[model samples]
Target: MKKIKIGIIGGTGGIGRWFAQYFQKEGLEVWVSGRRSGPDLPTMARECPVVIVSVPIAATLSVIEQIGPLMPEEALLTDFTSLKAEPVRAMLRASSCEVIGLHPLFGPEAKTLAGHNVVVCPARSRKWLPFVLDLFRKGRARIIETTPEKHDEWMAQVQVLNHLNTIAMGLALKRSGFQLAELLPVATPAFEAKVEWMKKIFGPNAGLYAQIITHNPFVEDVFENYQESLRELKKWIRRRDDEGLRKRIEQAGLFPAVRMKEE
Candidate 1:
């Protein structure tokens, strides 16, 4: 029997490393390549039946362009990018293989796929969808299948805006001239929680967060809406329009959303 092989282009760290370990546990021949080690793209494209692009968001498309043409038609080409639209489009344009845009909606620190989402965008994937879906299903992931464009549209708010808010708070604290130790000593519980969350996400993963903010095609609109909201809040604060602010806040509280029950 021929052994199954999978190659991860950026499998040395982050989610790539996590998946590498996962596949290793599953008894598949896992080949990992970094910038300077392991098998190169051409070799992987020829030998591996499933090739995953797991590089940084900034480097994903170029890597796809480089190896997409070398892939066998029966192989699966997929990515672990947060935003899906451009990567999915690039894979379709560059590869003849079955393409899937997979975004695991969690970080590498996750222990299990118990409740987190794994968004699957099946682009030109007829021969490999079952293989791809079964892999995640076995991992106990909650799968949400959608189009590449739709995935990115949702991520604009879920990822870009959420990161924007964290960066805003972090930058604001940096500009406030007080040391973190000083601020934390006097901060309310709510304020301290936000500060800690901001540091946890913004400190080490700044590049990834920046790429998420800048790369999404929908970010311009998100920025516009954020600024508009800030302007309205600023106006209310300047005028001491407590009633106006209260009413606006109350109205926003009623914004249409199917609020999820707490887990």
Candidate 2:
């Protein structure tokens, strides 16, 4: 049996490196490429039947623009970009190559994909669907097929809102002159959990978080809702309006029930 060759653009990054290792572990011949000028990337891309662009969201579109025409006509191209719509659209416009959008719902630090979810948006071909699904299954990942629009909407809430909240928590702590280490002993379980999330959010490149929030259209509404919720809470506290606060809490409880049933 012939091994499938995969070219991973931006293979030096954390996610890309993981994919390279994952593909190789699955017995696929893997090649890695970055934006640096070289014959190696084009050579690898041409030779491979599948190419994955794993660059940052900001650079993904541009990289697609550059590599689109160069990729072999028979090659199947996919991306690991967080926001899918833009990159998917760019690839659609740039090439006749079969394009797909992939968003890994977990971080690179995830050791196992036992409970991890990967979003897949198929474009241009049904031929590659089984191959992509099999790849994710080999990684022990749950594949969620969705349209580009749905992926971006959910990602805005999942990635942008979550990161923004964590960033805001860190900022609030800084303003309050609170040291994280000092709070650990006194913190509630929920607070400790939030702090753990904050550690992950703050540990990596800040620019990634910036790109997620900025590029996603749904983030502005999310931030607005966050601010409005804060203001409403403050108003309830200031007035000592126990009834108002209780009503708000009751509404929140009902809201999730509604969403849960809907989903």
Candidate 3:
């Protein structure tokens, strides 16, 4: 049996490069297209039976529209975008090819798909869906099947919420009189680890993190709820009301976990 050729647009770097290398490691024929190198998108679309858009979230839709139409009817038009809804919709609108929106929960730096969550929002498919599900299963990835809208909603709570919290922490530390050098000597190991994690967004990955925080439609709702929770915490802290603070913690189901640890 002849295996399908997979073409990854934006395969020069980041997650795209990761997939390009990973798929080759799995013994599939792979072709890549990038801004300055490799075969062009139109050529890839025409040649490869599986076309994946692994571009940044900001450019995902445009790339999808570009490559989707060129794909053969039997080809799979897919993306690796974090937020799924828009990309999936754009792919469906652009072509008659089988469309499946994939969001690998972990970053490109991950060593394996094993134990990691890979959300598969199969928007349109008969031929491609089973192949992808089997591929991830063989890789030992934990497959999560959901609608594109639901996937984006979950990301709003997970990625957006987590990144926003870290951003706030980083900003707060910057506003503090102490610099990293000053903090390091007095900082606990956990604190230092957290600062290191925070540095990722503050550095070269800043644009990617910014898109994760800003581009998703559901993030605004997460922000509103976060602000509401913060306001409540501040009110209790300002009042120096120990009982109120304890009540808030208990309400969040924290005390039971602490109690479990002690028992």
Candidate 4:
């Protein structure tokens, strides 16, 4: 039997390229497009049975707006973006094709899907849902079925807050004017580990992280909460309120998330 051809917009590099390699390994024919080369957007939209929009967060909607109208009704249209709500909505509005929103929880640098999670928001999909999900299962990926709104809300906490914390630390280090060479001599295991991990985010994934932080609708609340925490911590420090600080620390250890009733 002939393999289904998959078209990935912006698949020449990064996560799109990773998906191309992954699908090819599963015996599917893969075609990719980018600004510089490969197949054009309308051609990929019309030719492939499954057309995935894998452009950067800032460009995802624009690409979807242009190509989504070009897709055939029988084709499946999906996007691999960190924040799903807007992209999924655009796909639904612009295309008559089946729509699914996918956000691979890990970066392209990951060796394999293995234990990693892939969040799937099936917006308008019926027929193509099983096929797309089965492919992820074959790659050993844990599938998280969720609504686009819920997924974006969760990512505001997961991606936005996490990246904010890391960026804060990097900023603090810069303001302190402490050379890494000086810090390295006495760095704790945890500090060194964070430094190394953050280097990857601050390096190649820097723009992507920035986009995720800024594009998500729910991120403003996350930032407000973060600022409030900082102010509260500063107040405690200024007062030298050891008991207050201890109580705050204890409250955080409660891990309220783990205790939430499963939906």
Most TM-score-accurate candidate: 3
- Residue-level lDDT of model 2, residues 156-229, one tens digit each, is 77888889989998999989997988989999999989988887768767788889899997888888989998
Per residue, candidate 1 scores C-alpha lDDT tens digits across 165-187 of 98888888789887888877788
Compared with the true structure, what per-residue lDDT tens digits does model 4 show for residues 123-239? 998899999999999999999999999999999999999999999998899899997789998999999998986797778779989999999999899999999999989978999
TM-score of each: 0.93, 0.91, 0.95, 0.94
List, in order, the clash count of every candidate structure: 0, 0, 0, 0
Model 4 regions more than 4 Å off: 256-263
Q: Which one wins by TM-score: 3 or 4?
A: 3
Better of 1 and 4 by lDDT: 4
The model with the greatest lDDT is: 4
> Which residue pairs collide in model 1, if any?
none
lDDT of 3 by residue, 1-263 (tens): 78679898988889889878878877788999888899988899888998889888899888888887888898898989999999999999999989999988888889987899999999889988998888778779999999999999999989999999999999998998778998889999999899988988898999999998899889889999999999989989999999999878877875687867756
Instruction: After superposing candidate 3 on the true structure, give the runs of residues whose Cα lies further than 4 Å from its correct spot.
Output: 254-263
How well does model 3 score by local distance difference test?
0.89
Which of 2 and 3 is the better model by TM-score?
Answer: 3
CA lDDT, every model vs. true structure? 0.90, 0.85, 0.89, 0.92
* Candidate 1: segments with Cα more than 4 A from true spot: 1-3, 254-263
Q: Report the poorest 10 consecutive residues by lDDT, candidate 2.
A: 37-46
